[model samples]
Target: MVTTSTSVRSKSCLGPPSDMSPCGNWKVSIVTSDLPNAGTSSQIYIILYGQHRSSAPIYLYGTDRAPFQDGHEDIFTITVGDIGTLFKIRIGHTNSGLSPSWCCKEIQLWNMNSGKQFYIPVQRWMARDQEDGEICREFPILNKGQPILPVTVYEVHVATGELWNSGTVANVYISIYGEKGDTGSRQLFRSKNSFNFLRGQTDTFFLEAVHLGDLYKIIVGHDGLGPGNGWFLDDIVIRDPTTNREYAFFCHRWLDQEEDDGKIVRELYARDNSIIFARQKLEHNRKETWAAESWKFMKGNTLQFYNRLTGGFVRLHPDGTIDATGEKMDKYGFFDVIVSKGNICIFQSHEIRHLSLALDNGCVTGMASGRASTELRVVYQPNRCALLESVLVPGHTVIFDRHGKIASESAAGYADLSKEFVVFVKGMFLNNAVILLATSLCQALCLQPDGSCTGVGNQSEKSYWRVHKISSGICMFESVKNARMYLRIKDGQCDGTGTGDIDCHFKIKKNLENASVSLESTKSPGLFVGLQADGQAKPVIYTKNGNVFFYPRVIKCWHRVALLHNKMGMPSVSGALKRNR
Candidate 1:
């Protein structure tokens, strides 16, 4: 977690504080807004209150008050000792000062020991009902621990083809292999030999693997068939649900029978893996500017907009209002799943989970959240899950479904990844993940299993990947197929064989507006991750000249599409696996 304490000094007061001593082991800093109503030279004393009613409240600043500037937000931080666990703050103008009132825009507190700062904003302070003049509001509960992001699992499907059941054996068993093993290939589809059965329909069999490259070869074996004991097959089909790529094999005869006047041992062949997904990297500074504070997504960032409710999102509509109707994205439709402060934020990602945009009104309002809710059923629609804020819990933990009306009746909600990229990478310290794209020569970039790297792509099993995580949604590609090589830029392209391999590490910053990501090579300084017009999945050649800021290799990054079918994993050895194909 990046914090400001390391970079900016705490308690940067030009004038001396009225009180000379520090109170607790923590520090509190308050910054005022620069609006017109903001008091420029107002005098106000900050007081901290303890949980016990009998305990006297401590004045944050001694008798001397904090001076505020009219047009600029002012900063006032205090160091305190062990205050009670439960606390609140009271802001009041000096009794004798010229009645120029002040508004507290934002306040930040620092844990002196840990150097971690927490923030709070005061919209419009109100006075106490009692005779005493005091404006106060309790601080929000602090969020603790690292946030958890969503995890996505892709699907791999294999369908059987037409085969002539000429032999006596009616069923055949098929096993797939990326690399050969002594105990035969790993069986993905074990056949049931029933004569002339399952000849016409596409018998779909889902397979799972740690690496997709592990599936390159398929072996067809028969339990009992006469001489020439093989089945005359038509063709086999293989598809990746996530990447949306399909590999088709045209097998016209049995394993031994002639098919182009030769044998047909290979039942399936997919030739498109060589073709790399050519998405150009994005260029930020030239095209646009990003404010880090505004970009930093925090909880309680609410958006009251328009739209028709879908499963977990809203469709653009002319009529819109603030009502809890369905799920909506953060401000934009970018992040699918994000974790912040031990909370999980899930959005209705473009990639469909179970989309049904029917019978929904257009107007609705709701707060954006990164916290997951307790399980509940949809009141209006009992079949679906819910994500409403829990009224029962004082902390307001979120319920399972966004559209769910009743809190106690929905299924438990979980986070799902929205955008995904197939990448090859390895970790770099603060620089982030290193990529494994092609070099000027166009060879595949890779990381050797021995902690080294190469710039060649022929090692299919070692060079492919599916990247889903990054600090700012700007993820780098790593070779899961290869020995886990991270991609980087050497000169213009990354050379896995470079002297300081870490130098090739790059930070991909996503442009949520255009739905694109730009790669800034940390080593090359200003140079971005560029692509050669003719270089699709070939040798990476040359980058034109001195770092062109505007021309820093900009290309459209990822495309949002519905994953027709996913959820690929190891098949269980239970009754579910034994069901008829």
Candidate 2:
């Protein structure tokens, strides 16, 4: 936690005492420390209370046009004309803390005449947002000493699951806190500008340079207010520059200053860096890949290599190709991700086998290729939930997963670049096969067993419902508040139930004309589900399905959307991306 300040004058301590010396008029050359990532340019000025022999000390401010930045530059040369001894000199800012305040880690004062230099170490205080109660975070700065692991802030993700409609801020900025020498802690780095964010979207934040093992506080905040202002955070990915080791920090909830339930900031422990998928590649040797109804194209920023020869999208596929025509089951696409030791494997539930191909021989023959290894180098993406995995091929390279893999701009792939903002940040890997949520028309409010959104005894937390797609247009609503319960059709009546039996499955038919969804009971076919104006859902017929208009909304993450496919069309549940919001 950042400590409160006490000094009325912006206080600071100086190093190496020096006696008052006089040659000509003492020339004070002050050099300010440069922090390039420390937000916008700030007008830094030193104030000196000039004391006369008798009268009250006069104040003088100094700083020429040259602003303070990440370099050694003479901010000003004060002409403290020969006098007994001027009062104390302190640093202050022209603008408030909203902007990056002027800060110097090390300040060198040179007496031009005597060529004597005095150095002062001032850590932190780059921008004091806490004083204004800005949404900030306080954590420790890790890895201070030699074998320091240079870690990087990869990206920020938020689960816009139902309740969090936080369009909270137009832009959010980040700052890093670190300790310097004897100085307790200060702002080590600040984002140059605010990053654009949407309430339930994954925003790629300004990459922050950091250290591992040491506690470092990161403050992600916005200076705006009003509708769509509550920010919910999902997770953050930190990467080791040297080994490309990624640590995933999963925070699945609301993070708002106004939140009474809880704060949005979290200190996520870094997972082992052993699972690195960055330099590896998951190659698909299967032909007619997309022909599998389970296979759909994922959206994101990774290269998707198409084997035009077989019209198959490489990356994720079943052990062997099969038609998904007669199954009313979870789309055979999503792979139940299994993390093993330092490696990972994709378990194909439908195939009842792990996805494997292109072994030591780099060929697609089950005969000669001994047995495909389940071991793979799981390189995590910036968001950390997804992987850019590669098979355990001796010297081969390339990586992939869901959150679609559009080739890097250069098309040279991972080898041609170090860092870049690809397509989508994170996604649910349907066995790397591109699985989508099978239900839609968008949004549903959770209903307590009594048809009340307010939980038993009026608990608010039990109100939101999370829709999990099971099959074609069929979904099960899980309680956002009560994990044990799910929206179900009990004895042909609408109610909340604990078990996910066939009665809980509802066929979500899209009424495009009405711009809503139709939930026809899968078990008791003729009856429909309806929601009352008071927000209660009940079993009803097509005529009374009026209030069934409680459309479930889909959440998407976006820093900026670059839709490669420009045209819009009706989305069908036959094959689509899984709904995880």
Candidate 3:
């Protein structure tokens, strides 16, 4: 927790910290976008902010090898003091190099003092000619928010048949489709295969796209223009970098103008369950190998079990209850692997009670005194679980149905939005305001002396909003400090009303990739609360207005509050571990 003091300094806390001032060491990791020529040679500077104080703009420098290069992650550490509860930061570069623009993918900051990490997704370009033409950007910390859909870099390996005239130079194009979406047709312009596609050769190319979840099939073809465009593709294997899962599409048939089906394009489906069974067999073998060496480093050492299916940490409670809902490494989230007399391994929580985790009748729970389940597998390095690389605050699974109704993971014994969440609003004129409500007459909901709403620079009791989730994804913003006020849209106009009626209800559709959110009026389907030219909230036609998007960045303290609630609800266990069983 960041300490708040009456006196704060607005300066950089460089060098070592003294005993007089409170200091925090932050490890900042940044990833540049993979777009062509997205790197920047200009000097970058960042200013950190806490609840109150702000840090001086510190120049960011990297080794002479290369910094801010395309598709690369760079790490740096800085020491600062007096800034409490880091909330926001301003990052930009001095436009002075040959290619000064930069497309940043995201940033991760770790506080050594709190052992807490924050992720800031910035899939935007900071350039003079790019979208909105804004160089500097401010992003608040994301805590207990929607999971950002990762941009997965897929490794596409195309294998040519080991037969005559099996290679094609007619500009082969490929497209992959999965459950969530599809990557548009892309040409195999560049390949790791030296001479591109050739007979009996395996050419590898990289394709970057939004994660498509479970791949189903792929379309591969050639232009069929060259003299010998006939090609016999043996198979195509694609590896998703995010999950390390590979999908194989077999195609033993020839894709030629006058061969087989005489087609230039062919669709191939993913292999059936045999491959999955084989992979599972391999995974079991690997786990057994690890169990063989478990005696060396498994006994009496604190560790956490990561669920392979759901990206969550396994947590055991003091009262012999367990769940797989933890998102960080904490006291309750740690456990000891107890190897008994018969070489059987038991999972014991790192608590005074020493509860054992076990599975019984398809349910996973912690028992005070019973036979622990040895069915638990140890994946030393689970796919995408890079240990604190992208750890987020623990949050309940939230899903939006096709009808825009929100659904919580309640079947798994998880609660929905039960607590008041704090968010800083961005987009339009109310750029960094804490209050999301604004009157059609006023820019923001500022209570004046006359008891009327007006626009003001200073925030008051009326500025704070409490997200009151009435239904799954449907919520009404109520004033936190002043309970009488609720953000309402009446007759297609935005305003604050004392009455919390149906007009206040809004259907929230949050983007899985970033903090951008859209609010639609439940009463008026196509009517949305969009921003006017001056940044005031207004009800605009959802189809006509593009400014209906807004970013609500969750504050870090909310994570602490959520963590506390999670700790208090330790008596109940989660059914998420059933997949492992």
> Scored by CA lDDT, what does every candidate get?
0.34, 0.38, 0.59
Ranking by lDDT: 3, 2, 1
> Model 3, which residues run further than 4 Å from truth?
1-147, 272-581
The prediction achieving the highest TM-score against the true structure is 2
RMSD of each: 34.9, 18.0, 29.1
Off by over 4 Å in 1: 1-265, 268-445, 449-488, 491-493, 497-502, 505-581
Candidates sorted on TM-score, descending: 2, 3, 1
Please report the candidate that would top lDDT against the real structure.
3
Count: clashes, candidate 2:
58
> For candidate 2, what is the lDDT?
0.38
Candidate 1 lDDT by residue in tens digits, 1-581? 11122112123222334443333444555555565655533345544433332112323332234445343333434443334442344444443345355556766666555565666556543222221222333343244622121111223333332222222233355544433111122222323333232433344544432223334545554443344444445445556454565544444344534223344345454444433211111122112222111122232222121211213333322222222233334333222223323222232222332221111221122323322231111111111112222322332332223442212222434432111111111121112222223231123334555544443233244544334344553444555544334555664444333333555455654332222235576555566654332122212322333111110110111211111112244343232436755
Clashing residue pair totals per candidate (backbone < 3 A): 59, 58, 2
Worst 10 residues of 3 by lDDT: 382-391
Which candidate model has the greater lDDT, 1 or 3?
3
lDDT for each residue of candidate 2 in 105-198, tens digit (9 for 90 to 100): 5444454555654444444453555222212111221222221233344433323322324344534444333331011112212232353444
